[model samples]
Target: MGLAEQRKTLGYSQEKMAELLGVDRTTVGRWESGKTSPQPCQRLALASTLKISLQDLEALLAPSQAVERGAGRPKASDHPSSGDPDEMIRREFLRILTVSGALTVLPLDEAEALADGVYRGNPADFARMNSHLWQVYQLARTKGTVYPVVRDQLATLREALSGARRGNSFPLLNAAADLFQLAGEVAFDANRYSNAAASYALAASVSKEAGAYDLWACALVRHAYVDISEQRYREAVEVLRAAERVAVRGDSALSTRHWVASVLAEALAGVGDLAGCEEALARAEEVQDLPEGSSNGGWLRFDGTRLAEERGARYVQLGRFDLAEEALKKALDQSSLAIGHSYRRRGAVLADLAVIGARHQDPDQVVTYAREALGLARASSSGYIIRRLRSLGDEFGPLSRNHRIAELGAEIAALRAS
Candidate 1:
């Protein structure tokens, strides 16, 4: 029997299996569908969970030889295809992940030369590819799927840097900085705070070396998120303050400084500085006046589209439920959020609203918003949303005696395994 048959026979739903495996539900789906195989590190646990030997598990995972021969080896279509560009990018990235495994074992010089031949010595090509990867990462339901590609890209980038001439190294450094931030993002989404911090630190160092002030500032902002996630508000403020200083050196036309201020507002709110948070948020609002191309869509997407949610979140932190509810409801009215284009943003706003309900001791309101947020968390497989929901779950202490609230808490707790 196939993996899916085995799973059913064992009476394990995909979500349950995913929880036991510490992976996204989509990852488990891919394994059963024969679209991908588990990594070597994951195979032993998977085999044990399946109540099968490692050798038996491999047989189940292997593709049918007859089907393979009939269809021939899988390959990217050379002709132009129509679909979401992000989806196309994801497929291409998977292809690269497979090929890069072999390249990683080659000597550094040889790997560098091979990469150079592939890209024809143009750093812009690498930059563009990295940008696409970031878009794909943002849109992907399963964030861990991007890890192997990011890891391989970093390896190729290291080889490129080691062999580049000093005169041509700046562009490579800029590319490296950008990719490192994406790497940090993938790690951060998976709740690997230390690894994320390390990646962001490297991004900041490389950005400084490349003389890309905006990139450097953005890296520092991301680094601050690790501190913020751990509730080290003072430390986050210090990092963001440094980010603000560095952003001053970035191009005035860019929204780098304003983005720093936006994040700074969150940090200030964490420390109970209501006045400071409002001031920083006001500075962030000035980004609306900047030209259309003020921020790159990849690393710096803050174009005031998130300000409403940010304001609501900051007020929530300071315990101003009335103001928080007003702003968060306004945020939900925005077209993108109303349409549910961004599962992460919508999920976060819903979780925040649920927190407001908990604060008011309104069990029905809490359950309503929390359930919707939980649905988004499951659909998107977003760790950020899961984290917000976990915080919301903590606020359910007084309401937990309610049967519905207790069930909701159990569901949110299950995401911890995911």
Candidate 2:
């Protein structure tokens, strides 16, 4: 579940949610964007609010499939009750969980030390810190509950970035950009769109200074998301166009430029410009022709199929039912596994399909897509998904008495009220 869905299901406004969750509004914004996850307590609270089991909430909090580790044989430790276990093994497992739980609430200095212990090398440290920051950002979306911790960490990271700049360290510059982007992500989760945009813009600039084209493109894409969310389609297109230009000069063309173009298509379609959307989509299609080894698997990891989902979303926006159905079907069939890891993404696809149904005045279609989307929205804790569901409900204004549509609307209303 996305943070936005959780907020909606719980009937929390971004600011109120932040206050209740003990976080700044910006932190909530980050969680919605998949830039972060909630801490254990926050997750419990979120689950309680959404009326989901803690186990289901944990499933939502798990890392996206994109970041899942490689498949390997199970360890002996995997069988907790195995007869081969030493007498002291269970105690150690409990101890580890206890320590890990305590560490989750540690202050910045201690957390940094633990991070250093967990990731000894510079590159490993970068990855580890980035991952933790992502998790923190996610948890921050629960509202006020996690704001103080994230705020302190961002302050520390900012200071570190400044120090690196003074030392003329390139890796530090890269790290600073990454950290700033993470901070921005947290801000976004809390619905602080302007702050999120500013931070991402700064990250893009710093990445450029570090000569990290992939990072720069990523920051720009994130910024575009902010614009898109605000329905500033023209502004979103302009930002994406800039990203496209920057991406062309980068090492990861297949992913970078393709993603930019795909987003541009969605933005254009949102503005009701079909021709522009089609043009951008065609460029995205061209991205599929890139060679297999073109992706570096860093930031710009597009392999063409990401655009498929965008195409479906754009067609939905354009009110092209046949085209939307075709694109959405293809998107569902070929989307990356990570897309399914977040209930929010799945709900978004369903929401798009619901819109298609609503446009055609098909009550059955609306019920089928909207109800499942509402369920997913509740599971994910995403305000944005609920907002989208509201849009779908609006589509029923002309057919309010339609029993199926009204039932779907009532179900969504109840979810939002929870």
Candidate 3:
């Protein structure tokens, strides 16, 4: 029987099932729609509710005869909810948290209770818990909620690296790389650029040792972002060049490498190296040469349409107002239709348009786009977005006498100060 039928047999509504499973109704909907299957815990709950054995639930959840031959089964284990590596890493991290006395921020008893949960949980459960904690960490603003855990996370990641270096095993090395990448992300979010760069470099080295080229390219791209943030355009160019080479060798058809190249072009443009910028842009544009759906989506995902956005931002830096305006507008339109949610990307492009408008002395457009982008950036809790806005606000310095522009500038400055 289908999941829905089983739910009906158990006399449970989607909402009810979701509540029992500690998930949303949409998750239950996905399960019933066959888009995903329940986790082992949820499966056990479902089986009990349906008066069935775990074995029976497993069989019922298996691919049906209606599935076409040679078509792969959508194994539940392959889904993000299932074999999540992040969960395991998080549990291990928490163990270090207790060991390092970082958990002292919480009541001793509460910390022990959490440690107990970590100890009892399976790897997937740990991963899911970690993922949830990270998400919570991202949205949470309290210093009490962040500092202790983040510090522990950093310590855990460092320990992983140390452990990996002591061992020559590929698994240990790969695990270290994964932890380092996570550490880098956390560090970047905290505006610890040097730490982020160091983590990315370590990740790249581990990736090389593990023979994982895609991971190496990803690390380099992350490192390049740090360089770009510092306005070290020459260093950025060098980093991107190395990243481009690694990306090409690893997976030329992937969109990420091309996206890396596109951003690299922007860095090149920052230095007034027009020729190199155009060439890098040309290479980035070549992502469309791959046949549709050829990308693995694991790495090398440069599908090319984001060029307008990149061009808009780059041209804004070059003071090419005309080009920036056209490209920025087009990017805004294209991004509106693209699938998925990237508040960061949307906010960035809108901020670029704002900068373009500011450059052209178009007060109305500047205010409209900048305010909108600022709101989105705040909603996304993006430090990078805030930094971009601050930089754009600086462009309004020449118009400081204009009350409206000055107000906008002051508002952005306030955000940066905070």
Rank ordering of all candidates by TM-score, starting from the highest: 1, 2, 3
Which regions of candidate 1 are displaced past 4 Å? 1-121, 335-340
Error of 1 at 81 (Å): 25
Better of 2 and 3 by lDDT: 3
TM-score, cand. 3: 0.62
Which lDDT tens digits does candidate 3 get at residues 97-191? 44334454445555445534543433232333344344434333321233334444434444444544444445545545554666676667657
Error of 2 at 35 (Å): 30
**Which residue runs does candidate 3 get wrong by more than 4 Å?**
1-168, 291-302
> Model 2: per-residue lDDT, tens digit, 1-418?
5556766877888888777767788777766654444543356666776678878766665543122222232232221111212211222222222323433555546554544432222434544455554444443323323333334434444544454545555676676677677767656655678888998988899899888887788789889989888889899988888888788788753567777777888899989999999998998788768888555433444566566667888888888878888877676665445532345556777888888888888877788878888876766567667767877877887767887777788887876676
Estimated TM-score for each candidate: 0.77, 0.66, 0.62
Report the lDDT tens digits of candidate 1 across residue range 1-418: 9988989999999999999999899988977876555754466679999999989987887653223334533333211111222222333453433333422434445434443442444577668667656666766666666776677666666767788999899988998899899999988988999999999999999999889999999999999999999899999999999999999999999999999999999999999999999999999999999999998877887889889999999999999998999999888788343532588888899999999999999999999999999998887778899999989988987799999999999999997775
lDDT of 3 at 107: 55
Note each model's CA RMSD in angstroms. Answer: 8.7, 13.4, 15.3
Q: Which ten residues in a row have the lowest lDDT in candidate 1?
A: 78-87
